[model samples]
Target: MKIEVRDVVKSYKHKTVLKNITFTMEGPKIIGFLGHNGAGKTTFLNLLAGLIATTDGTILVNGDNVFNTPSTLRDICFIAESGNFQEEMTIAQALKANSFFYPKWDEQLAQRLLQVFALNPKEKVRSLSKGMVSALGIITGFASNAAITIFDEPYIGLDVAARSMFYDLLIDQQIDNPRLYILSTHLIDEASELFEEIFILQEGQLLLQKTTDEWHKHIVAVKGNATDVAAAIVDLEIIDQHMFMQEMTAIVHTGGHPIEGYNVTLESVSLQDMLVYLSKQKARSGK
Candidate 1:
């Protein structure tokens, strides 16, 4: 499956949330959507899943437009941070309902996930704990087997052990099913490994979109004597920097050589760290 968003724009009450955003993704892989709060990631994901319509753009899933078309959206599943299960229904009943909606639903996987999450199928949606509710959402999203599956912080209220369980299950199921997974989460480091590609939204703008491998390769962190390191990076734009009494640590968009006298330590940068630096840079530039 492939997702295509072209010239996408969304606004509420004259305020734009997504501005002229354009990107394309070929499926059967996992993607991590990273951004700060109110970065329009939810809105963007909603648009792709057809929960909301774009103000001016086209969202195509597997070559078919998702808006105003039920057939096209049937292959896509979008689960929010809060799973919108029927309050009066039991977990088993809700699972059955979801099975009817998605053509490729896997009952075995759902049942297995229920045991994995320690959720009782007979429990009513309203009676389940917050962690249970998140567990149910994760199970459904993964077992639905939709070509384009999107999860918005699917493990919101789980404990550390539970969250790790969810991550392990997601990885295993992905290897077997291999559908498109779009995950939005604040737990960036925990989920970064599952991401083959990355999309970053900042204040309603699509700031960056690249593969995880490529993003890591393009970024570098250096640490050495403050003055010498500063001189070495004088010509380059510093995304982020930390300074102490004598030495300083800085991250930059690597371009030229290192300073001769300074002892520089060039190290790999994580996607989360890169985004932090990028966001800080954007903030400083605005001021």
Candidate 2:
């Protein structure tokens, strides 16, 4: 399922949430949507899922407009931060409801995941714990087996072990069945490896889009004499710089210039650090 957003805009109560956003997503790969709070990530996801209408421009799934079009949405599954459950229904009823909507719904997988998460089908959603609710959302997302599956901060109230299990299950499912997966989360470091591509939003605008491998390519942390490191990075865009007792470290963008001697050491930048630096830069630029 290919998703294409062309010059889209969204607003609520005259407050603009997305501004002239445009991007295209190819199928059978995972994408990480990175942004700070109120960066329009939710708005964008909702637009793609057809949960809300775009104020301007257009969104298409496989060339089909999403809003009011069931065909386009049939293969798309969106699990938001809050999965609005039928308060009067039990977990079993909710599962049954989902099974009818998703053509590829897997009852066995859902039941297994529920068991793993220690959730009872007979329990009412209104009475479940926050973590349990999140677990149910995760299970729904994975078991739906939609062609395009999206999880918008689905692990919000989950613990470390539960979140780890969610990640593991997501990756395992993707390997077994390659599909389009878009994940919107603040836990970038925890889920970065699952992403084949990365998209960043800043203050209602699309900031960056690149393949995860290409995005991380040549990004290194070099430490050595402060002066030498500074000289070496004279023309490179430095993402971050820090100093220790006798050595200084600079996090440079891809293709950083090499410095002679001074014990330069290259390292991979964590996704969390990448997100923090990107957000800081956006804030500094007044975006």
Alpha-carbon RMSD of each model? 2.7, 2.9
**lDDT score at residue 15, model 1, on the 0-100 scale:** 88
lDDT of 2: 0.85
What stretches of model 1 exceed 4 Å from their correct place?
225-238, 254-263, 278-287
The residue-by-residue lDDT of candidate 2 on 62-118, one tens digit each, is: 888899689778798999989557777899998889899999998899999988999
Model 1's number of clashes is 0
Error of 2 at 10 (Å): 1.9
TM-score of each: 0.89, 0.86
Question: Model 2, stretches more than 4 Å misplaced?
Answer: 218-252, 255-266, 282-287
lDDT of 1: 0.84
Model 1: lowest-lDDT 10 consecutive positions = 254-263
